[model samples]
Target: MTLRLGYGTNGLTDLRLDDALGLLADLGYDGVGLTLDHMHLDPLAPDLGARTRQVARRLAGLGLGVTVETGARYVLDPRRKHGPSLLDPDPDGRAARTALLVRAVEVAADLGAHAVHCFSGITPPDTAPDTAWQRLTGALAPVLEAADRAGVPLAVEPEPGHLLSALADFHHLRTLLGDPEPLGLTLDIGHCQCLEPASPADCVKEAGPWLRHVQIEDMRRGVHEHLPFGDGEIDFPPVLEALASTGYDGLTVVELPRHSHAGPELARTSLDFLRRAAATTNGAAPC
Candidate 1:
């Protein structure tokens, strides 16, 4: 299977969706990790069917595949950054979060996207650990059900400072959910490096069976900054080799929102880097 290369719209947050697609196409990406938000195609907006069709047609024109991501800050709470989480104190607030994710799943179904990238929000500051997990799983059940009905996979991403912070945490989450088919992992390589002692390559191998989506970015050993290619401590060659060995036929999204101003340049550089890395691993000449 070919490795699918894509970029996150988080990096192109300033550009219109059409322009972002055109720029990504021109830069030679095969897919996009479209982060659903207000400025871009707001998945919560009215006339979602028409909007989905429009986006699908545009992506088709560009020959781009998509994976929907739901990490938009403040989408649920205007006054808080990632507030009203799935584990919120208020039951109504948690339901609101679930409804938002259900909406995202419907949008993903409409676009024929491969999967939806989701995350467990930060635990409320004062809640007990057991209570937090209970609330989180309880909040996630409805979204998982909706995704099952829509025939879409939900990839739960482990973030640096969130409720689910590592592969081990993800394993715990999977066990808590009691069903692996509807819930899978979105392995963000940078986060793994920051939070775990294992190398990114080793993490990929360890999490091989559970990985449904992947994100790549450079980061230092103990920090979570999403750096551009070659700017951090990650050894891309071995990481690519590990992915190749797994025969993972999924999107490897380049997520560097900080470099959004250099979107075109970053996209070109990242794609070229991946091509060369893959070619070297396969004993083929780089383009």
Candidate 2:
């Protein structure tokens, strides 16, 4: 009854991609949340298929699973952070983002990744709520089609301050998309702690059926910041128990994108913390 834990590569920006993967493998992590970025696999790079094949081999050799993450801050737009979102007012801007996500689905298939993680970006200013919803639904349609074709689940995350900021918003999206099979949820534990009315453990239980990917970190209520273990108000043991009970087989990835300066050290310590927490959970041992 253990959860397979992994770490996100976005937190290891300072290390080479090879070194980062090797480091996680050596640390006994079961998988990785691989963010497609300029430094790590570079989704837009030339010969992307060859690069993806090489990474597939690396993960296979290391016995590590993967989930392709599409939250690279500047992969598409150099000047804007997470710009050209699904809800962008400009049609071309939204298409660019959709194309990137489609490419991500291809990469995920090649890597044999568990899922492809994404988010509906922040709602554009001066936009009506209904219009924003229309833009998002329109934008994600092709990406979902790509996921269906690739046999990969698209795990859309509910990011704080974004268009889809909560669990209800995700349900709204599901309803809008007509409950597509390839559509699934990436539930962030910290997000629950930060904004959800229910406890994080309860959120896990409620989201179980739709869960495809899970990102975890310690965070205080009402704050969106991602914190290391023991630095926030989350009670992790119950959350782990709930997660294990859900029968979700995907990686519960440690997401610390801003902690790359100390990525290796945090990777080691974070695993230790999760293992200890899992040990306390009703015999749900962590690997």
Candidate 3:
């Protein structure tokens, strides 16, 4: 029951994409959470298919798996962080976000990624709850279709301060979309500690079936900041134990998008921390 660990490329923003991948590989990580940002893969860049193919080859050479992530704050609109979300009232605004997810599906398929990660944005102040739900479902439908065609799961994360920001909200979304096969969950361990009524381990156990991707970090019970392992309050041993118990085989990526200044050091220490945690779980494989 090895809980494979990887680091998010968003945290390695200071390095070139190739250099980031190489560093993770050299550190003995199993994979990477490759965010499609302007500095990285750039989903909106020209000759994207060619670029994706090149990245795919690089990943294969490095023996590192990948999960495509669409969480770049300003990729879609430079002025607005995470702008033009799926629940936007304007049709075109919603379409832009949907298109990005669809493109993510294509990239995921090309890269043989286990899942494509994304999130529901903050609800507009003027939007009604029902209307926002409607917009979210409508916008995600086509992206789900594209994922279905590409044979890639669209792993929607429950982001704090966003419209769909809880495990229950993820269930509601699954039901709303009629439980499409390609739709899955990106369970973030820190987010559970931040806001969930259940403990993070319990949340991992419960989300086992729908979970296709995962993000890990340390955080306090109420605050939303992503912190290094020992800096926060999460009891990681039980969390890793529950993750292994669930038989989830996807990469549980280290998510530290703001710590690029120490990305290389964090990446190394994070792998060591998680390896030690995994070792504490019975029948766990060694690093």
Global lDDT scores for all candidate models: 0.86, 0.96, 0.94
Clashing pairs in 1: none
> Where is model 3 more than 4 Å wrong at Cα?
none
Clashing pairs in 2: none
Ranking by lDDT: 2, 3, 1
Question: Best candidate, lDDT-wise?
Answer: 2
The alpha-carbon lDDT assigned to residue 167 of candidate 3 equals 98
Two-way TM-score contest, 1 vs 2, winner = 2
lDDT of 3: 0.94
lDDT: the better of candidates 1 and 2? 2
Q: Name the TM-score of candidate 1.
A: 0.96
Measured by TM-score, how close is model 2 to the native structure?
Answer: 0.99
Q: 1-287, model 2: which lDDT tens digit per residue?
A: 77799999999999998899999999999999999999989988998999999999999999999999999999999999998899999999999999999999999999999899999999998999999999999999999999999999999999999989999999999999899999999999999999999999999999999999999999999999999999999999999999988999899999999999999999999999999999899846788
How far off is residue 26 in model 3, in Å? 0.3
Per-candidate clashes come to 0, 0, 0
